[model samples]
Target: MLALPKPVKRAIAGPPVRRDGQQLDLDIQLLLRLLTPRRPQPVPPPEQMRAGQSFVDRVVAGPEEPGVRREDRTVPGAVADLRARLYVPPPGPDVVDGALLVYVHGGGFVAGDLDTHDELCATLAAESGARVLSVDYRLAPEHPFPAAVDDCLAAFAHVTAHPVEFGAAPGRIAVGGDSAGASLALTVARETSRDGADPAGRPVFCLAFFPVTALDGHTRSRELFGDGFLLTGEAIEAMAGWYVPEAMRDDPRLRIAEGDLSGMPPAYVATAGFDPLRDEGEHLVTRMREAGVPATLRRHPDLVHGFATSLGIGVRPRQAVAEAAGALRTAFALLGAT
Candidate 1:
């Protein structure tokens, strides 16, 4: 809805719901119930679906955060120059100056761009007091597989090399995003933190919001929440197919959870209890911790996938983001101290 629907307003104002040991946020439940069609409908072509993504973001995320300052520019990518947006939050005593988040936008690897996640970057910049650079990596089906991965790594390298050019400090660079973007961030972390990697140059922290850690796998969470949840299992597969071929589904880039996790930056992986990717995201935390990385996992039991972007819908989403921001602040402090 471009504006909050009456049903959504009612859901936001009502008490939350308890179901199956997980409390679904009332507003999220209402939105899912209202948006899901009564009968199956043909999935739109990629171009049409991309157009609808912009419209849906405006409707769900509302206006971008008011006080944040935005600048549009281009950043270096491995295969091509990519459009980018830099967000500088309003300065205040609480602001953690020079903290940088190389933010990636997620729309199942095929649909999202910087505009779809505009308010989200602003929210992260404002809440974390970090300068967030939103990357518009080449989408799949057009760019496919390693294009996204290569572009993100190249963007991260550019930001680290010229932090002041983007109004960020050199050592405070962090990588973060939601869903597919998060998957890319984790891959960056994995590559940058390999054995013999320079500790001082690697990402100091990573933030993942309900990351799709595995493209092929069946889990209880997927079976339970695959349908009628904000992100369906079928939808996940369709989007992933655009990014990866059937034979390459076993590649570490797509099946990220099974990859080696040693030497990763301190990480925060948040999962929504009612999300199909919940189990995989949680599994990422265990894998990271087992690898001796200082990683933390926060499960928002009341939320679902995509809640991180709906700042206009309810408070829970913002709260979850705020927590992630706090983690960034702490990581920045540690990085600065070193």
Candidate 2:
């Protein structure tokens, strides 16, 4: 694996940050503090945001895990053809047979693509020892609201129907993603496994990392950590404006927290300590459990939103993501996906 510059790594290895019974990771506190302005500022336009994110990803995300193979392919989506990448981990005894994870990349509905989350996805497969399909759904502005959701569902459907073609064993599909993608992944999990849904069509598990479930909830975490945490309230509103029209912001599909959560497969919802979306993600786990779905919410108190994307950068991030990937692997095995 590639390492960050010596100076950068050394800076993050400094003294710890503690507050509210939680310790903020040095990496997030330092990097985001350096980047964040004293006063909150509006994010750039969609195109600039995309470019900036891509550039930052390259600078921060070092490299893909060695020995994990990658293959690019086209997936049939609801709106248009979608791009996707399949990841197969290094050969190992723990590798599950006929199991796969359908992953979605997060960009708050606008920025991410197959390349931005390349190392992150590779880590998921490397740590879990399971095949992963990372989908590149349509972005906002060009394709809004249900466009991303529809594309994801279509990719999952295609992989489920033709597992062998995608280098997976049959009937062992799982769903996962981070941030915005986590919302889509959880949505797919809910829709495919809801009440009265066919057993054969349901996913075995859902793996979400700091998911964005509801924008209107105005939770305590949002108020406390919305600014200077890499992802801000202003940024959220801007992205939402581009992705969802005001008239349809109330759609249950967009605000998944208010939607039905019953009859879904077991889930592992991971959250960050200082993320504006933290409350909503944890809330989803709580509601899922209340609805009788076996769910677990793991909070990484030392991290912020997008920690998963920095898997190759900071120690805590890699560890955090690996823990979730391990859960994904266990879920696949325990649920008979292996």
Candidate 3:
């Protein structure tokens, strides 16, 4: 077979064209081009969940870093045992007492598991030089409100009590997550701090990526980015319905926007400009700062929701994760100094 010219092949495989009136980052545009084109289908919830998992499995890269060691374990949960993955990086020359980051995966509280976030967790461990524990909390609709929350709390407590076993310093633990996971992480931090939990059991800091701080969908970002962006308003509502009962939606525990932020751990909140949850995440950071909780916010104006999970696709997402990991290292350094 005759080989095509390089220029012609490059032209044929060019980046995807940008949508009209959309201002997405170039990397994201390229990622969209690489994804398989498909017509929207209305599958049953169970089937849709399975399809989502399959899609994640296909797109997300597998563990490729030899520096990071990964191990799976069944951790004790409030109601039952929860599946968890621990990623530990090799000790560095400067390593004194390393930190542990308990990460909760984001699937809108409906999908996602340890497998879906395996690569991301591994990257975090390697980048931050901290032991990363990714929790597989129960999903909603079947598990419902307080189920996932309870499971995450239990996992955090277990890890805090046994940090030495995970090769982490006893009092140098942090909590973080993306989307629904971020909300859960913040909740755990809030509850732990509020209860005057032991210093060793409390998170030194918290990190959130495009977290859904409130269930309300009336923010300006929601109006602007709710439809065309990856995370639609309809999808958010559906996940909220599946996760929390109507009566409990406004509970401070579930709605971080309405919760007390005083005494909560210092936080680093990152939000994408084109994400529906951008405003709420920003608002949460603002409130936390106003409440005397040290907090920082980083906004990526050209990116969309779930950009953190696209680490394998482009530079911007990787840059964002690297920046977040750097922030984590700073947080741990500050903890050590204190």
Q: What TM-scores do the predictions have?
A: 0.93, 0.93, 0.89
Model 2, C-alpha of 59: deviation from truth (Å)? 1.9
**Total clashing pairs for each candidate:** 0, 2, 0
Model 1: how far is 229 from its true place, Å? 1.1
In the range 1-338, model 2's lDDT, one tens digit per residue, is: 12566466546545566655787866666676566677766689999999988987876775669899999988899967888899988898977777899899999899999999999999899999899989899999899888888888888888888889887866688999999999999888887876776676678889999999985658888898877678888898889889988898888787676667888888999999888888889888888888888999999998989988886555888899889999988887787733
Query: Over all chains combined, what TM-score does candidate 3 have?
Result: 0.89
For model 3, give the RMSD to the true fold.
3.6
Candidate 1, lDDT over the whole model: 0.84
In model 3, what is the error at residue 261, expressed in angstroms? Answer: 0.7
TM-score of 2: 0.93
Model 1, span 1-338: residue lDDT tens: 42477575655545565655987876777677667788976666678878877777787895568799999989989977999999988978868878889998888888899888999899888888888999989887888888899999898888888888998876789999999999999888888788886665578899999998888868899998988776888888788778887777677766666767877888999999899999999988988888888989999998989887887766788889889988888888777787
lDDT of 3 by residue, 62-177 (tens): 33656778898878888999998889877775343668899999888888888777777877887887889999998888988889889999989998998887778888899999
| Candidate 1's TM-score | 0.93
CA displacement after TM-score superposition, residue 103 of candidate 1 (Å): 0.4
